[model samples]
Target: MIEVKHLHKTFRIPAPHLSRWERIKAAVTGDGAEKTAVRDISFTVGPGEFVGYIGPNGAGKSTTIKMLTGILHPTSGEVRIDGMSPHKDRRRVVSRLGVVFGQRSQLWWDLPVRDSFDILCAMYRIDRQRQQRTLAELDGLLGLGEFADTPVRKLSLGQRMRADLAAALLHEPDILFLDEPTIGLDVIAKRNIRGLLSKVNRELGKTVLLTTHDMDDIEQLCDRVMVINHGSLAYDGTIGELRERIGLPTILRVSFEAAVSLDNATEPELGFTVAEANGCELTVHFNRQELPALEVLRRLERYGTAQDVHMEEPDFEEIIHKVY
Candidate 1:
């Protein structure tokens, strides 16, 4: 479990120097300028919960994660992981946590994949039997056997991601933090990662906190989601709740068997906004809050027997856009 309250983090950045005079002026100005990356943000993740933390670029999502993982210190407020302070007891806290940054690798680039695992075993001081069991389980779940002897630098993006994921779990951490775990991965590779994460959460009972820009990742993997915008908590709840908050409308596209025009008639009382219509094809937007989808269908029958109907909800990108 993780709890963060009124957490704040700020970074002092040097101002750009326009001339030698400006450089000298900044040295005396003391740090030039400061940017508050995260400001008074607060949230909690329950044990065994899979939560997605999402935001646009520069939204402070990474800053918050770094603070939680003890990679960066917070300026103020409290962060507790399973009742332990990560800042004060970083080693003990990290032992109970797993972290994977998509843009960074934990594996040794020049070493064989298996050797990297071995080094991790030594670092964590895991016993031989436990290490073997963990590696075997990871190999089965992540399919790392195919390139176990290959050097990390020689592996593909997908393979490297799987290897990184395996390395993160070698210690059997209670909580996992994944930052863009599926970035730059092909469809199959992304599927593999998602399947592995689902298994880890369901069978292994690991609590997970995932930060990603991909809506598919969040839709497929997260049960609960937290949206951050402008360095603040914009939304937090179930995925369905988020959809409703954004007023995301479901689209129903209908192609009629024959062309017909009811343009002069009173608009059908479907509790939906008409998005588009062309002779036989009509697109309607129905707010789930105002009407259940099935009811919308019954109302559409009055126009004509629909040749086909396609229903779609908003994707993660659209939802984030609405939040921002």
Candidate 2:
């Protein structure tokens, strides 16, 4: 299990234009330029659980990840990875972690995929037999064999990401930390990656903490989600619970074969609001808790036969916006 207690991180902001006397005066006056990237936040992850860490840009999500991975030290409080102190036992903590940063690469830029895996073998000290075995398993899961000999620089974004994931798993870490693993991929590629992650979490029984801006990732893969905003833990719970708690309207837009009957009349049957209506099309905003999708569709049928229908869930960003 991973545990964090009241963790905090602060950084000094450099001011090159400040005169030395001005800097001294500011420091003496207790106005030193500093910013807190992370405030006192605490959360825990049990074994074999998939959790999504999401927030807007510059909301201390990456900073928290770095601290949890032992890349950055917390200014205060405690971080324990599998009962080991990451600050004191970084090596031991690292051995249990498999981290993948979407914008960063751990693979050798000039080396082929196989060569990079070979290098990871030495770095993680994997025996030849185990290396081959892991490679074979990863190949089956991630389809890495086709690009095993491709140099990192020559591979496409999807290929490189698969290779990176393979490299992270070669050592058989118990916990995987993925940050925006599907940031720049097509639909098929994203689906493949999500499949791999689901298999890893369910079949392999591995613990995963994924940080991403994609709501579908949270919906499909994570049973629980933690939302961070302004360097503090704004919300932490299941995504379903979040939607229920926030009580945002799930949008249902319908295009009818004939003109819609409710052009100006307020909807009184289901206590829902017709946010927009234009002749044959009507956009509805209703609480999912009050009226489910099927019931909403049933109510819409009264107006006319729907030629086309589209349902939109309250996205993660909008939920966060509403909460904050």
Candidate 3:
């Protein structure tokens, strides 16, 4: 289990390019401002749970992950992984944790994929016998064997990601922390990674915390989601609950040979908004949380005969924007 209580992290940014005299004055007056990358946020993740931590860029997602992995210290509050403080008991906490950052690599760039795994085994002190067994299992699950002999720099992005994932699990860490692991991957690559993650979470019973801008990852693999905005916890709940809470907007675009009046459709509480009105086409947007699409379509009939009607659901990015 992972538990965080009132977590906070602050950084003091210095005023740069100041004159010496001005510097002295600024120091005395505390002119340098402090920015809190992570505010007083708190949440917990039980064993074997897959949770998605999402936010726009610079929203403290990485800050929280770093603190949890003991890569950085929290300015105040507490961080506990499986009931042990990450900062206080760094080695022990780290031994049980596996972290994957999409923009960063923990592997040696010049080394073969298998060679990197050997280095990791040495660092974690896993015996060769167990290492081989783990490799066999990972190869089966992630198909790492196909590119295991290639140098990290020579492998494709998807291949490198698979290698990195195997490297993290070579020692079989209990909890996995992934930050944008599927970034820049193609649709097929993303699906493969997502399927592997689901197996890791469900079959192996590993606690997984994934952070990504891709909402499909959350929609497919995550059972619960936590959204952070402006260094604070903006939301924490199941994905279904989040959709219901926000009432995602859906659009109905009607094409007509002639213009039709919208006054005939009167559902004041349905929160309808006119998105576009042209000479022969009309567009109406309504919240799915307020009413069903079928009902919305039926009401639109009152306007007039439409040559063609098209329904559009907002994209994943739009749903997340609503959360923010």
lDDT of 3 by residue, 1-324 (tens): 999999999986557888888878877776777989999999999999999999999999999999999989999999899899988899898899998989889999999988999999999999989999999999999998788889999988888888889888888999999999999999999999999999999888889999999999998999999999999999999977786777766788888766777664455754577778787788888877777777866666666777888887767667789888
Write model 1 residue lDDT over 113-165, tens digit each, in one string. Answer: 99999999999999999999999998888899999999999999999999999
Per-candidate Cα RMSD to the true structure, in Å, reads: 2.2, 3.3, 3.8
Best by TM-score: 1
Candidate 2 per-residue lDDT, tens place, 1-324, comes to 989999999987547688988777776775656899999999999999999998889999999999999999999989999899878998888889999999988999999999999999999999999999989988988899899998999998899889999888989999999999999988988988899999989988889999998878888999999988889999899988999899988988999998887743474766678888898999999998887888888877788898998999888668867866
For candidate 3, what's the RMSD? 3.8
Clashing pairs in 1: none
In angstroms, the error of model 1 at 276 is 2.2
Task: Report clash pairs, candidate 2.
Answer: none
In what order do the candidates fall by lDDT, top score first? Answer: 1, 2, 3
Q: Give the TM-scores of the predictions, in the order they appear.
A: 0.93, 0.87, 0.84
Runs of candidate 1 with Cα error greater than 4 angstroms are 18-30, 264-270
